[model samples]
Target: MRATSIGAVLSGALVLSASAVTAPAAYAAETGVVIQKVSVNGGKPIVLGTSQTESFTISVTASDDSGISSKLAFLQIKREVGDNYWSYHGTPTCTASSATTSTCKLTFKLDSGWGVPRNTLAGPWKVVVQLQSKDGDLYNNGGDITHPVLRRGKLSVDAGPEPVAKGKSLRVTGKLSRANWDKRTYAGYTNQPVKLQFRKAGTSTYTTVKTVNTNSTGNLSTTVTASADGYWRWSFAGTSTTSAVNAAGDYVDVR
Candidate 1:
């Protein structure tokens, strides 16, 4: 059987993307999974502030030539740092928001008891959907089941204080966090540099005002004198082990 071996990893293990689906790929002819997007707290880049609990919704699409051996289908989250381990944290039962041979979608949450641990390590991690063989399926010449292709995924960020008073000091705060496969919680990314940016209400461009660093708890906080009403946010440049992220814009009123 001609198949690409993923090695001695667990039968629960599998290999790796974005845009709600992988951009596209070259082939091995084995039916595999595509991770459209893995949202942290319902956002990307998995940014949190001094928080341990979270919600994760993994949008997955999958297929297989052997009618999609549905029983072994599951989503796994893997962290790069620490144990660098991977596991299934989605749910015990398989319930698709939608399903077809060419597509399958599932959404689960951490608090719902379907996500990673409450104290999982935070950083860039892999969100995988495993499309494995079923009871009636046949192996390729007795070879190990193959994982055809895999791509990478993006991180997430969340910014706030929807409106700030003008001329008054605006307190901007957020968390630097990412997926932790071991514990399944989106944990803080402590002691990292994050740039604060602003855009006036009349302008479309944002300029960097100052840089703030995360504390021991991965909390980001800073104050900027209010001037013109516009938007404010934080941007993490990202290291080799993590992906870059820009927080959502918070509108401020300088009145």
Candidate 2:
């Protein structure tokens, strides 16, 4: 079945605060499953070095013969660091009130310096979503559902000016950005490696020629000589766990 596309809004000045402590609520008697659509907005595969921010929204619609009343949900972000795992340490960054009609929607900002740990890689990251009653009953799978896991659909990086040319040596510099989701910037390079693929224009295929690690700033730069250049293109790719697949950035025309 085709999934619904959720829209998100992005802002650089938005700061998401954790909700205060509150007692959990009892589960709702609803019987139908909650259908949600998740998407990233602002920019895909965020660029490295450049400071960028993205927003995400989860629109939920639920119907049950039991009649749904409570309209509260919990959202959390989890990232993989090295061999271990880390989660947003404090309170939930996202919450939604019950809709007066039938649908409930919540939005949050993932800033560059949000909840990211000091040490995070540039590879695949995951965002684990959970829907629960303030009381504690699971929403999706009855009591069996502990969390709703939806991996980021796509992650990408954007490097401006693909076929950057100087004099003779082709000078290319681009920023790395993540798409389909937002990430916090750390003090060093991301745990994942950024791979660059390049091929002369006219070639039927390309090859992996260079690789670089996104620094704390998520910026990368490289220079290569173009031999008898017709046209050339370069690509940058990376991935994370919470995100469903890999992300990429591309550049072209280095003559």
- TM-scores of all candidate predictions against the true structure: 0.45, 0.38
lDDT of 2 by residue, 1-255 (tens): 111111111222122211111112332334233433322222232222213344444333443343334444544444455685654322233333343123444444447344333224333333333444333344532222112222222223333344545445654454443332234322222444555555555665667767766566555566666443333222333233222223332444444
Q: What overall lDDT goes with each candidate model?
A: 0.48, 0.37
Per-residue alpha-carbon lDDT of candidate 1 for residues 1-255, written as tens digits (9 for 90 to 100): 011111011111222223234423322233333333333223343332222344445444444433444565555554543654434344323334344233434544435553443333443355555554432432121111112111111222333343546566777777776544444445677888988888888899989999988988777788878878777777766653344566666776666
lDDT of 1 at 109: 40
What is the total number of backbone clashes in candidate 1? 16
Model 2 regions lying over 4 Å from their true place:
1-53, 70-101, 110-194, 197-225, 228-234, 241-255
